[model samples]
Target chain A: MGETIDLKLHVWRQSGPNAPGRFEDYTHYAKAIPTHASFLEFLDIVNERLILAGIEPIAFDHDCREGICGMCGVVINGRPHGPRKATTTCQLHMRHFRNGEEIWVEPWRAKAFPIVKDLIVDRSAFDRIIQAGGYITARVGSAPDANAILIPKQVAEEAMDAAACIGCGACVAACPNGSASLFVAAKLGHFNSLPQGKPELDRRVLGMVTQHEKEGFGGCSNHYLCEAACPKEISVKWIAKMNRDFIRASLRYAPPVERKEGYG
Target chain B: MASSQVLSFTRTAIGQKALVAVTGIILYGFAFFHALGNLQVFLGREAFNQYAEMLQSMPKLVWATRLVLLVALITHVVLVVRLARRAREAKPAHYRFEERMDPSEGILRRYARQTMLLSGLIILAYIVFHLMHLTVGAVPGLFFVRGMAYENLIYGMRTPWVAGFYLFANLLLGLHLYHGCRALFQTLGLRHPQWDRRSFAMALSITAVIVGTNVIIPIAGLTRLVGGELPEDPQEVLRTGEEKHTVSE
Candidate 1:
């Protein structure tokens, strides 16, 4: 004996970013869905029904079908990842919703993220930001012995906290200012705070921030919507750390190769 | 070479924000000291005039300081306007039903964020008007004299509308400074949880101290606590070298 909720969906439909977009209404039948079903699972049932009815399934991006992938995202009822705190769309369950509720679903809307089709959006802008300076340039070799390098436990924890960013673009999607400062800061903090990643710190920050601006992402004014919308609950402190490191790198850094060869 | 690197750094978003933070620090220092200096009025007319004269005596230093402030102000305003425009263009479509992404943020933080641009513009307008009334002696009045800054301040505040506007402007300035400090510390990477535990308190207290002193001067003048009975023509007082006018209070 399971409970089911009949519902209506007003989902945005679009062919591409350049094409016109509109919300198409769909009504779910009185079939009782399992009360324990996840929101995605509910969507899966609706999509199945649509396909069987000779209609195209809603296009959305999801992988791993879990919260970790950071691939699944949609603005449900005018909220990024639905009306939940620190929860991603894939992790959201159907039990959170009331029966006969009309859920409005739309893709993440930003100049940097263009809608592809239905709820899917182009997030390659985030990939470009990562490619700019997201990785440490350390030489690849057999895994170094743990504890070979002594890093302060607190520093390591902070770096790990910053590195938890999944590049979901939720920060960008959720920010009222559409600022990517949080994302850029996360990438910068993950590396700048680490010893192995220290050498190219200045260049990495400069490249990523330049790339972020080029991607048309807005600047952060400490509105902190990203922190609230984050599935990982990444703190705005990392952004502050990034700003500090960026300023230092901008002012004091000289490429290691440019150091004096021999001082007389 | 470092200067050149700094110049190049100023081209990015973080760089622009760092400029705002740095300039904001300078502006904060100026406002804090300016409020402290203006509070000399409560010590009576002689003390305030001596303070004004001391500042005016160092013409070169005063001019240099003014020029630096002008440059910093322009840079802060320009960069902020440009960034605000960029933020506006970032999201063309509006969310129909907006929900609080973070409900934990207090009302002060919300007020600071939403009112930043508006308060900044209002403060800018106030600065220009204030300069006209006192600094430039350009505002047509019987009391605005280039060297008589104390009298100018008192006379300006004697008008209820002017005094009221000053009070309101300083209140907005308090709001701006409160948020500006919080944002600056974050932007400059100066925040540490140990010290940041009191960041809100620090910001609020600093704003209150500065704006509190500033708002007092106009209130004092409007209520006739200082320089209440000065005649329209002060030739007799000037001839007698009684520049230090009597204070009833």
Candidate 2:
């Protein structure tokens, strides 16, 4: 049996989007939590106790509970996903904490990401950025034969590294300026590194970068806090790549000239 | 059509970042060469005054260089101010319990990175004061005589308050350069993963050289290490300057 430890949790509470929020002390209910329990599980225990006492339970976002879905995240003790490197909040276990320790939890803070409820933020801004140009145009036919593209091993590995980003928004939370450069760069790298994604490389970079700026995300000053806060360990190198590509595309990619007269 | 394309390009955030990087390079080059040129003060009155006269002889070249530096300085300041505003807007709210993820990072790196704007503004103010004190010789109470470069420098730096201001301003400039030198590469999309360490080393060396020479000049004057003896009359200093110029010619 795992050792059970008591904890003091100061969870952020917000009734609605427009409501004022504060950290509500949960010391009375968060007692005897198993050390093996994940952070979400610990929250569940606290919620269950609140529900039994005829009080409204805490509301937070979670899915899959395995850190793959990128849906669960919260700032704990001022760091996104707590202090463990490359571990999401859902995978953070209570064993990492000592008995009777106090944890302060808050939601991701950024102008682009608006608060929807307690511990849940409106992340539709990410969707808008992706919609701008996060994909390549492909034919709607039967699947192509395997290994036809013939991507080199190194290139494929690098693309896979960029693809490891889970869109968790932890990078935004961790950045002092709340910049989303890492997330946008990872997406650009994932697509631009592949042969199939090369045809629209210039357009993709240009569109996505402009969209990111339009969404109120800050520019990258290379502080690299995003790399440190990333649960997927996405490197800031992708941002450098994005920057290189953007400069090249802005210079060389000319817009199509307008015709003065139409075909008769 | 071409002009329109250029206009549209500059409107993007990346475009402004590229401009900032390019202008920063120009300013850095000016700082480096300016520091090296000013180091002639250590060689004593004749060498230093001759160097100043040589620069004054080429009026066209001096004005052209000044114009370029003026443009670069203005562009750098304006773009950085706009970028900083955008960054502030991006994060309208603050986290109540925010902490640095990596406490192991050096305090200098943290302080320099986070306070770029603050250091930059202070350095800009210093530049204005510096131009007034040395270049234009318009500061009241400081001894000034036209073309007496060596005497002006020695007399100006000997004052305790002026020397102290120079020391403080140069230290802030050092901090600004420490981050600016490294960030320019990233801004221009020139940084590669393999060259990260080398780039940092390059930035450190450049900042050290520029700051070292600039900081020492004032200290040299303050401690009487340089500037042996100044003639009481301004006309006497001018006579010596012209004599050296004629001899060199």
DockQ of each: 0.42, 0.48
Compute the lDDT for candidate 2: 0.87
TM-score of 2: 0.93
Native contacts retained by model 2, as a fraction? Answer: 0.63
In angstroms, the error of model 1 at A54 is 5.0
| Best lDDT among the predictions, by candidate number | 2
Which window of ten consecutive residues has the lowest lDDT sum in model 2 chain A?
A: A255-264
Model 1 misplaced regions, further than 4 Å: A6-8, A27-34, A52-55, A100-102, A139-142, A255-264, B1-7, B140-143, B198-200, B229-249
Q: What is the C-alpha lDDT of each candidate?
A: 0.82, 0.87
Query: Compared with the true structure, what per-residue lDDT tens digits does model 2 show for residues A160-198?
Result: 999998899999988877789999999999999999888
